[model samples]
Target chain A: AQSVTQLDSHVSVSEGTPVLLRCNYSSSYSPSLFWYVQHPNKGLQLLLKYTSAATLVKGINGFEAEFKKSETSFHLTKPSAHMSDAAEYFCVVMLTGTASKLTFGTGTRLQVTL
Target chain B: EAGVAQSPRYKIIEKRQSVAFWCNPISGHATLYWYQQILGQGPKLLIQFQNNGVVDDSQLPKDRFSAERLKGVDSTLKIQPAKLEDSAVYLCASSLSPEADTQYFGPGTRLTVL
Candidate 1:
C-alpha cells in the first residue's frame, strides 16, 4: 500500500515570508504525486502534479514542489506568502495499477499572518 | 469548464438514519470517484467508477454504503443506518478518463451524524 505523511500539522508564516510544507511518501513502485489546496468552504483544488515527467513542478498561485526520488519527498514551497494563501494543503500519492487510487496525507493547515 | 458538483453542502442526521449525497462530474469526464475524509485525517477512496461501470469498490463498505453512477454523468452515494464513524466529508471527483492524471473535485458534502 502507498501512503503519504505530512510532517507538519500546521504552519504559520508572515506575509512576504517564505512558506514550506513537508511531505514524504512510501510506495513500492514509482508513484505519481500531487498537491492540492482547500480554502475555507471550498473544494480541493489541484496545485500541481508529478508524473515522472519533471522533477520540478510549478503550480498555480506561485506555488511549486520538487519530486525527490532519492528522499521519497515532494515538499510544497512558495517564495513569498500572502494573506490569501491561508488554507489546508494535502499531499497525495496515486497508487499504481488499474484503479489508480489516490492516497492522501493528513492535511497541513497554513496560516498567513500580517 | 465547470468543476464537479455535489449537492447538500452540509447534512446532519441521527445515528442509524440513512442519508444520500449526489454528484455531477465535469462534462465529458469518463471517470468518477468518491472519497471519505474524516476530520483531522486524509481522504480515503471509497469507490471508483468508469463511465457507468464499477471499477474499484474494494474499500467501500458494501453492507452500509452503496453508490451508483447512472448514465455515466450523475452519481449518488447512500449510507443506510449510518454510524458515528461515518460522519465525515464526502468528496466527489472526476477525470477526463481513467488514464487522465488530473481529477477535478467538488465542494464536499459534510455529514454529521448525531
Candidate 2:
C-alpha cells in the first residue's frame, strides 16, 4: 500500500518570504514521490520528484524539495514566495511494481499575501 | 511539445444525467490516467491505461464510470446517471511509459451537479 499525507491544509506566506509545505508518505516498497502545483482553474504541474536520486531536487519556477528518508518526508520549499506562487499543492506517492498506482495527499493550499 | 489536452473545460448537469470527457495524451506517451479531484481534496485515480489496455480501475465506481483508451493515444471517460456527489474536477495525465513516475496533466474539466 502507498499513501501520502500533507501536513498542512493551508499555508499563508508573505510575498518575498520563504515557503514550506510539509508532506509525509508510507509505502510498502521502494516508493516514488512527487510534488504538484495547481493554480486556480489550471492543470496540476509537476514541481519536483524524488525517485531515489538526489535527496534535494530542484524544480521549475524556483521551487525545490528535500527527501528525508529517516523522517519519511518530502517537503516542498522555496527561498522566496511570489504572489503567483499562491496555489494548491499535492504530494503523491507511487506504488512500485505491477500496480504503479499513485496515491495523492489531501493537498495544502498556499496563500501568498503581499 | 504539446501537453495533454482535455475538452469541455466545464460542464453543468442535473442528477441522473450522463456525461463524458475526452483526453488526448502527449505525443508518444504510452501511459494515460484519469483522476477525479473533489473540492478540497487531492486528485484520486479513476482509471489508468497502458497502450490501450486497462491497467487499473480499482478506485473507479465501475457501476457508473467507464473508460477506454483506443489506439493507445486518445481516451475517454463516461459517467452514467452521475450523482450530486460525483461533481468534481476530472483530470487527465500522461507519462512517457508505464514505469514513469512524473506525469503531465491537462487543465481538467470541472463538473457541477445540481
Best by lDDT: 1
Q: What is the DockQ of each candidate?
A: 0.74, 0.79
Candidate 2 chain A vs. true chain A: TM-score? 0.96
- RMSD of each predicted structure: 0.9, 1.0
lDDT of candidate 1 over B40-71, digit per residue (tens): 98888999999999999999999999999989
Q: Among all windows of ten consecutive residues in candidate 1 chain A, which has the lowest summed lDDT?
A: A94-103
Put down candidate 1 lDDT per residue, A9-114, tens digits, no spaces: 9999999999999999999988999999998888899999999998999999999999999999999999999999999999999965666788899999999999
Candidate 2 RMSD to the real structure = 1.0
Write the residue-wise lDDT of candidate 2 on B1-114 in tens digits: 999999999999999999999999999999999999999999999998989999888899999999998789999999998999999999999998878777899999999999
Clashing pairs in 1: none
lDDT of each: 0.94, 0.92
The regions of model 1 sitting more than 4 angstroms off are: none
Instruction: Give the residue spans of candidate 2 off by over 4 A.
Output: none
